[model samples]
Target: AKIKRVKGPYGKVHRGFLKGLTLVWSEIREVIREWQIHGQSVWVTGHSLGGALATLAVAAFGEEAKPIHGLYTFGQPRVGGKTFARNFDLEYQARTFRFVNNNDVVTRVPPRNLGYRHVGTVLMFDHAGILQTDLHFWNHFLDRVVGRIEDLGKPGTDGIKDHNMA
Candidate 1:
């Protein structure tokens, strides 16, 4: 996907993700305002591609009259570059939880080398389905090794299998 600089505080993000958000933002904003009017906090969540859009939605809502209560995403890909990640983290790090299931491949792209990066705190589930917070790289590496070995007989790669929401 191509990167484009949005004309707001989010810095540069994935063009496709930005376009997806733009297509539905007005409706989403209206719903959020309706909820806020009733004194309800607005929490956003999505999985995979939707996750990426959810991230942009929260950032877009940051300057609105009502703030987003929280954001949660699953198997989300990198949405932007360093500036966007840093800015988003500064604002919503405590309010965002990004879940990665085992070796879910979606979370690792569009490749840091391409200047894309993920925002929010990561809460990962290892191969044994045990939840881990802020796991060290060595520990994460060993877990992936174990998962791949266990998945040797499986039809698909562990990364792809792990991406399943189920």
Candidate 2:
């Protein structure tokens, strides 16, 4: 996965995601416009890699002065850098919800060390499958420990299992 600098409301974005959006942006924009014309709200959603593309699509719509009703993503990876994240949050944070299941590893990348960051409100499901919002650091750490312990007899890591949409 490569990172590319883009000249727009989105300062930097995942290259692959940008390419994917470029391919279908016209149709997506048209659909949104049609929905708006019919007095319908446009909400976007996706899981994993599709989530990244959905984020970029919303950003594109915002740049074009199109309003989006809301966005929801499951087990989504980071799609851009700090600037892009800040911009996205500024424009859409109130209407965006990111759902992370337990230790789903997909939500943790591209790493913060690499300047990638997540945007919007996070609604996480803990190791016990309990929904958590605004979790404290200590609580998050404890849940991770519990998840690892529970994975002791499992064939694969909890990260993969938690990423399952089901």
Candidate 3:
């Protein structure tokens, strides 16, 4: 695959992710070739930070690359800005599945306001559970990391708890 820095609205990304991919590209290609020699399919998966890396790896593989089967990511934060996201979505729409907990705080980081965007189909989970309605220092943690559900219609209560892996 052609190597170049992938620029995003917020900043350049090929330095961080793509550079890493390039460093190992030869080895990865060799591995894939070896796998293909045995008629094996390649499927990538990761969670949290690993998911972000997997997303980049798949992109580096190129859209039409053979032997790569699909990607499945969990609680992956935004990896790049709109352009990268758009390209990734377009290229891998049929194969990428991004699973995000409804309120996973990590998924909301490097916010869109900062020009970061998410790619792939977001498989959101809105699991029902008791919520801690009262505000607390752990509100974001509880709502997102703990996956609790407050009463939806209650005054001052919002269904903000939905971020847990559970």
Compared with the true structure, all predictions reach lDDT values of: 0.88, 0.88, 0.65
Q: Regarding TM-score, does 1 or 3 come out ahead?
A: 1
Model 2 compared with the native: what TM-score? 0.94
Off by over 4 Å in 2: 1-9
- Candidate 1 lDDT: 0.88
Candidate 1 on 1-166: residue-level lDDT in tens?
A: 5455455446888887888888998998898889988999889999999999999999888756368889999999999888889888988999999999988999998888888888999998998999999689999999989989999987988999999955
Question: Candidate 2: worst 10 consecutive residues by lDDT?
Answer: 1-10
Q: TM-score for each prediction?
A: 0.93, 0.94, 0.66
Give RMSD to native, each candidate: 1.6, 1.6, 8.9
| Model 1: residues with Cα > 4 Å off, grouped in runs | 1-9
Tens digits of per-residue lDDT for model 2 on 71-145? 999999999999999999999999999999988999998888888889999998998888899678898888978
lDDT of 3 by residue, 1-166 (tens): 3223365323344346555556776887788778878999889898877777778878767643654678998887777877787787777868888876656667775567766777777666543433333434365355444333344455532322333466
lDDT for model 2, on a 0 to 1 scale?
Answer: 0.88
